[model samples]
Target: MSSVSTRASFTAPALALVINAFVWGTSWWPFRQLEARGLHPLWATVLIYAVAVLVILALRPRALGQLLRTPVLWILVLASGTTNAAFNWAVTLGDVVRVVLLFYLMPLWAVLLARLVLREPLTHHAAARVLLALAGAAVVLWPAGRSGWEALPLPRTLPDWLGVLGGFCFALNNVMLRREAHRPEEARALAMFVGGMAVAGTLALVLVGNGMASPPPAPAPGWVAGVAAMALLFLAGNLALQYGAARLPANVTSVVMLTEILFASISALALGGGHLDGQLLGGGALILAAALLSTLSGADAH
Candidate 1:
């Protein structure tokens, strides 16, 4: 590529990454709206991701061939799928601020998963990053007025647990991306979108079968339109992620993705959908600081 072309490729991918973060940051609102229309978040997730998957397969039939030839892509499917299912469900059940902060703990998980899966050495910086994240999580999860190491802090609600678990899956998803970096881009994108459908659809079926969630009602034109729009946005964001992750360093992508926390926090608070008290602020700072650490070296190798 020419010098100007090279620069555009780099900058454009980074911008696309930021766009992905922004879309995810603001996505909770639509999930909540769909829930109000009797479409449980899980069901909505299934529908939205199903649509995205159909669109992808229709446009890139060759991507399916790429995926079937790549076994690792199946794991990618599971990781990315569970990440979406857990996060979408958790956001509907928990405060958006709390859920988002928990989810952004991805840096902590990324570092550890990298060390394990990629055999990256644990440096002092990475160790400190882990400690800071742990302390921050403790501070955030510790209930108000309950202080002084009274007990090991634990996630208190369904959303809280789901958020943390989803963060772990997200970290795994990213690690797999790095692991499979040499794969066809269409294949990688196909894995995530298809995973979104398979995982969420399976979970939705189980929940509805057990009466824990209602079967999706006849589509209200209003919510169906909203679901269609959000599905398109998610499809775009996934494409952006593939573009950005391919062009940028993995660590840089992780750090830029942290902007989702800021976007979610501000939007949730402004909309009266979430609270922002002292502990959350302090804890979120520490967690984000750990993520920021990775960007300093501009490398969190897979």
Candidate 2:
């Protein structure tokens, strides 16, 4: 018989990462939907991850102890929480395509973070992979000719900058996960869940104080129900991410996870009536091709 089952050990985590991608890809809609009902994205994140924190603590009451012993997990809490806060706010306030294009720049961040944190050597294959990923991002993010080629490739608006910030935080979060893979998974999960609550909750308080963002409105039954549903989805996605990311090399997980862009693109097109013009189609193919090459090369440095 073939060793097909043996091969599955690696392949399965790749598939799990894809599942995580789908959850995140379409996640913006629920945030925006909840926002429409007077729940700000920060508040929505607070509610969703708050539920996640409670659930995790209930299951593993001692999980917090491990995080206390490992100070690095606190960095994870900051990274993961800031990531959600940035992306959720950016997407709700800006064009989905633009925000996603900037956010998916995680591969660029990943290359450097992996080398720095995991001490993974940047092989020639990985160098080439990062270059290709950047090229694809250029294709997708290049400003229209309306700007007459003088436009900087940098993010201009507040939301665009938030997307970039979110990508950096995401890269750090993933790197931390790889570094802490030896620790109890429950501690890692608990740290991330609590980070969401702490970061978003703190920011929400600032905005409310400054009169920029509102408090969690009087909870209408409909919105409360929606928050509960989104929380459950977030919890599931978190578990899937832990399963895949903890098993795979950090860089490989980052590369495979770019499929989230594809998921986001399709969902945006369908829900927002976005037109799939030629440039978008071509750019997406380039991005996907780069990810495929990374998988085949398997330039996964530990």
Candidate 3:
């Protein structure tokens, strides 16, 4: 009887993480669809997160006060906000697989950030993982039919840059979550939700003001429905993430979250939003290998 209860407790959190992964993995399709309907991804992020924020506030109004009073949570707000804004925009404008692969570089950034923020020692194993991940990134960024400095493995497109940026911020967000795990869960959730809305909303307004991007089209059933659905989905996913991440070791959380890559890859390929090739497969394998190693090492460390 005790064993059964223990297993249930363990399984529930792991499954919750999987739920979060699935929501994000398939989110690109909806973002793209909304974009087609004249809703920019930034604007869509604002609306989706706005709904989520309202729901959270309705249920736990004190979360807003907690987030505001806790100075450390402000870091979480910026990190989570930047992660969603950058990733959503990048995935919408870039090859889904490539963008995802780039974003999954989170592990590399995680290793570094954990060391810096958590004061985790930079062990030899961690260093090796970093090198492996860097090699994988180079392979992924390697250009075809180019040579010398011109072919340097660097981000050449806007989507590529955004992917890298999002990955870094996501790493920071995860580290901050672990750091502040003792905080009230609702406060953390509120911070993340608010970040998404604030960052995306500010960017959208800036772009619209400068005529760099079109404003959100007048409300229509198509985008309205999409935004509403996404709001609920993201809210659920965020809550699951908070619950699961808080309960599990960060390394274990990372391993489970890798399913996001598989989900994104399959969905994008099936829907024609992405393609596969030798270079990508090879590089992706290397990157994932490094990430797996990093997680295992982190678990062992703890």
Candidate 4:
């Protein structure tokens, strides 16, 4: 009975994690398609998030009032918004493997920011995990680095930089979320979703207004079908994340979410859409190991 109960305990979150990973992993392909069809990824984000926001509003109009009443929630909005927008935009613009790996650097960010934001003490185990994760990031993005002062002890590629920055921001975002964990989970999820839309929309406006990118063109005939699918997936993914996040420790959740990198990397490789070189492979192992350690370490803490 104990064995059976132990197995059952892991079932739901495992399934949710897998589904979320698959959604995020394959998201890049459709985003690229939309880009090819003249719909910028930012605009694509806007479309999906708009649907999510509307759904949330329809279900809970009071959430809006709740959001407005809390300044801390606004801070949450900014953090989550930057995380989602920067991560999405960066992945679409960079190497899938690099972007995903860099984003997983959240463990490092979470540890440091946890100390500052949540007043959580940094255990030796957590500190070790942070260093391991950072080493892995450096290995993965090694190909992007160059010579002289230009070489800042990291990858030399522009996409690699974008991915690293995205990961750092992601870490900060999650730390902030955990700091505000006392808030209602539903409210947090709503803020994250709405914040994602606001951030993406604002960036899009700036980029277009500044003539950095062209305006979003009318999508092809089948665009609506794709958009619908994406919207449903986004809503489902967000819901799963919100639910799982509320139930689990942030460290554990971060580890579970690392499954997204595996899902994306394997799919990309299988589809001949991406490559796995030595640095990326080695770096990925380190990152995975670190995340797993972090999760397992936190398992008994709560």
Candidate 5:
């Protein structure tokens, strides 16, 4: 009986983490679907997060006050908002697998951000992990039949740039969360949700003014349903992440979250949003290896 109880406790949180991973992994599909209906991803991000923010406010009305009191939380808001906006737009326009791989370069950015923001030491292990992840990124970026300078490991397209930007912001977001971990959890959550709405909403307006992007289309049942469902899904995923991460070791949480890559890859391929080749496979392995190593290093530090 004791053994069974212990097993259940561990399994439940792990499963919750998986649920979070699955939501993000397959999120590209719904985003693409909304885009097809003439809803720009930036606008979609605004609506989805707006609903999520309302839900959070309803449940934790005081969270907004706490979030506003801490000025640093505003940085968290900006980082989290850019992370979502860039990622959602990138996945909608670019090859899903490539964009996701680039975004997973979070470990590379995390090392640098931690040093800068948290004043954490740049340990030898962290440096090596950064190099490994960079190497992987080079592999992914090297154009076929190109060599030397022509094969520069640079982002080649809008989506590629967005992917890298999102990853950088994501690393910063994580660092801020760690730096401010002493704050109330609800306040942190509220900050992130509000950031999503504020940043995306502002960007959408700017783009619409410039005619670079279209305004949200008139109300339709199909898109209305899609946006609502996506909002619920994101909210659920966030809750699951909080639950699982609280109960599990940091290393375990990191490893489980990496499954988002697998889910994204498979869904993209199946849905005709991405393709695979030798270069992508090899590069992805190196990136994931670096991420895994970073998780282990984090565990050691703890």
Candidate 6:
């Protein structure tokens, strides 16, 4: 009976992981469409997340109450917010492969943050994986064959930095999530979704304040339709991710996150007018391998 129940418990999380993959895999299309229609990614991010937060509030009012009672939840909000904003903005403006590879650097950041924040002592194997990940990133970001040390090698574009920053923020988010694993899953889910809105709104305000874009338009009728659809998708994705991550071990969950890159890459290739480039594919493979190995290493050590 215990064996049967254990197996049964895994089903929901496995299904949730699949749904989360599909949502992220196909997300680039809607982002592009919204961008073409003159709603920039940042605008769409704020619109979608705000609506999702409202949905969460309506469905689980208690989640907000939980958040209010705990200061740690607010920290999660900040971490999650920065992560979502950085990812949304980076993917919109950069090469899908390049951005995704950079974002996978989360494992390196995760390991370091885990050591400091969670006090999970880093093993030598983990340290090696981090170095390999960094080397892989350097190879990709190194300007087309200008590998000399004096080149001050860096990602030569704004989107590259955003992608890396997003990954770092995601690492912080994951660390906080792990540290606060004792919290109710509902509260964590609320923090993830609401924190995303907070980040997007703050960034949008900064951009507008600095004259980065024109003022937003007054609400429109179709805007309602768009926001509704966007919110539903965002809420579904967030819930699926939370559900899946909660059921799986940390290493398994980390491995599952790799699906986003696959989904993003394949969708970008098929529908987002992206092409597979050798430098990107090579770099991406290394980064993904490092992330997988890091998790596997930890699991093996245990």
In terms of TM-score, how similar is model 2 to the real structure? 0.84
Better of 2 and 5 by lDDT: 5
- The 10 consecutive residues of candidate 5 with the worst lDDT sum are 293-302
Q: In model 6, what is the error at residue 133, expressed in angstroms?
A: 0.9
The lDDT values for all models are: 0.86, 0.80, 0.90, 0.76, 0.92, 0.77
Error of 6 at 117 (Å): 0.9
Task: State which candidate, 4 or 6, has the greater TM-score.
Answer: 4
| TM-score for each candidate, following the candidate numbering | 0.91, 0.84, 0.94, 0.89, 0.97, 0.89
Best by TM-score: 5
Task: Encode model 1's per-residue lDDT on 145-242: one tens digit a residue.
Answer: 66565556789789999999999999899889888889987898889988888999899999888989889889689889989999899888978887
Per-residue lDDT tens digits of candidate 3, residues 1-302? 99999889889999999999999999999999999999999999999999989998999999989998999999998999999999999989999999999998877888899888999888888888888889989999999999888799999999999999999999899889879989998998899889999999998899999998999899999999999999999878978987897788877887998999999999999999899799999989988998899778873221
Candidate 3, after superposition: displacement of residue 299 in Å? 5.9
lDDT accuracy of residue 40 in candidate 2: 96
Best by lDDT: 5
User: Per-residue lDDT tens digits of candidate 6, residues 80-146?
Assistant: 8887788777778877767878988887887788888877888887787788788779777767645
lDDT of 1: 0.86
Error of 3 at 276 (Å): 1.1
Residue 223 in model 3: lDDT? 98
Kindly state the number of residue pairs that clash in model 4: 5
- lDDT per residue as tens, model 4, 66-88: 88777788877877777777777
Model 6 quality (TM-score): 0.89
How far off is residue 49 in model 6, in Å?
1.4
Model 1, 160: alpha-carbon shift in Å?
0.4
